[model samples]
Target: MGYSRLNVVIRADASVHIGMGHRVRSEVLAEAFSEQGAEVCFVVHASCADFSKEGDFVFGSESEWHELAHQADILVLDHYGYDAAAINALFQLNPNLLVLDDNNNRGDFNCRWLLNPLSLRYSETVQFPLTGGQCAQLRPQFSKYRAVNPIGQQKLLLTFGGTDPLELTLPFIKSLFVKGFPTEFLLIMVGSGVQNAKEIQDYCRQHHMECQIGVNQVSELMAQSRFAISAAGGTLFELACMGVPTHFIQVADNQKDALAEHSALGWCSATDFTGCLPKQRVSLIDKVVESVLKTWQTDLTQRSQLARECVDGLGAWRVVETVLASRLVK
Candidate 1:
């Protein structure tokens, strides 16, 4: 059967602590589901910003999900806070469940499908049947772009995802300036919900750098940049898509494993910001600056090729097809 008014409820959350990757990815899924004639709604926390126009957002307690669970033809989860028990409850309410996870750090989850591109074949290592059975590898939608030619681009982009809760922007700029990070290449910093925006803007102005707040055309920016210093989160996929060689720094726990794997695979260079308090990051500026300059000097031909090859923009379509096929099977 076709997706005629099929109800898809996406459960996720966004905040300074949780960051925005989950919500952003969920919005992408919502778009794909909506195109297939599904009614998509978001069940998020009250603190979450209203970022998507494609769906309605609802706020309530965990018990409230039962109501949504009852109405949903399928429930998609992206939030890390949801445990197995909670997911099991939702699964009992509605058997059609799909989980989008990165680390697989959580315990057992009784869901019909689990989408994790990183560990698709490493399911045995993570103790989950995430490879051969009901699991599907879902990459970001940016993998569809052609390799970016870096000849004319004279900018170094900096993005730390949505919140930058660790406040790495200003320190990174100062480190670059201290290391004299090529004044010929302009610096372009972008972010949202940044508490230190004024300080960052002032620093950029004083240093002749360009700062863009709340930018919507991030893909365009990434494609145009010659280099980037970014967080090792979902944005890494976008950077990889454009073949923009990046130096990644982790600001969340979920990103640690992926950072290690990606860096080991030569996709990007990484640094961990976990455990180290925000105040202590200032001392690590030299290390960050050294890594960025080193990576910039190295030839990126092979690294760019590997990065672009990892993701294809067709993941959303794949997910939609798989979900629909599973429904038909039922």
Candidate 2:
């Protein structure tokens, strides 16, 4: 079977509200598919007319989607907006459909394969395949980042998703200052499309903290970090693979499941700020930061081991291989 003849279409979105995890994940998958000689096209959704045009924008109606679905060899859905019924419609058009999801609540899946990298543990109650499907237990992208940096050169990393809609970056920096931000560990903050980018940069400059915007080298930074403060999302898996200890906050409601379960599994130090008020958040931030600072290394060895064991960083390859093999059999 020639993979070069295969065509894969990935449908996902990136916006302030939905976050950029889906878009980034789709890109990763696209690169993997392309590496295997598959023709991949990413059809990102535009939320509304008011939504700013970014990336490769494709406009089409439902009929157009059906048309494309008919021509595509495989259709990959990684959006929360797509329910099982909606997915079923696309499945009928193309039986070779892949659904990438974090939440196991998407009811029944009618796709050829289901990949849920978010949920590391395999259980009987899980919605997707436990052993047969591509779960991406160990992400392949983190291979370069797996090597731990010298402890003395490590910094404290800060990242709040791609958009940082909650504007948690600056406030978290201020909280650190309130607790007398340690000069020993350099602060590194990263974000794209953040509303408060200028303010954060100014604050960072004034306070001598490093602020990076629209960066593509996060895995590199994660490798050089002693610890990271990040939103509980896809980055969790990356951090785990890099063996970087993190303090996580569930900035979005959809992140609750992954964050809670990963934290329970001792992946990172975490707290839920879904509905936290200003005063309460300030207090909680201070407490969480201080607690992490004190015992950050208590389980560092074990956490890093679990992370390396769970996230091998070859998820993309596994996905490409599985999907292609399934195609040949059909």
Candidate 2 per-residue C-alpha lDDT over 1-330 given as tens digits, one digit per residue, 9 for 90 to 100: 458888788787777777778877788888888878888876755453233334443655667566666778888888888887888888888777788878767676576777877644433322334231134533344776576454642677888877787778887888777777574465655567677888889988898777778777777777777778888888888887787777888887777777766677675778788899876877887877787667654646676665556576778778777777663313
lDDT of 1 by residue, 230-306 (tens): 88777776776677778888877888867776677777887888899767888876788887787787777788777
Task: State model 1's lDDT.
Answer: 0.71
Error of 1 at 125 (Å): 16
Q: Quote model 1's TM-score.
A: 0.88
lDDT of 2 at 64: 54
Q: Backbone collision count in every prediction?
A: 0, 8
Error of 2 at 4 (Å): 1.3
Off by over 4 Å in 1: 47-55, 120-150, 328-330
Q: Give the residue spans of candidate 2 off by over 4 A.
A: 48-57, 119-134, 137-141, 148-153, 297-299, 328-330
Task: Count residue pairs with overlapping backbones in model 1.
Answer: 0
Worst lDDT window (10 residues) for model 1? 127-136
* Alpha carbon deviation, residue 30, candidate 2 (Å): 0.5
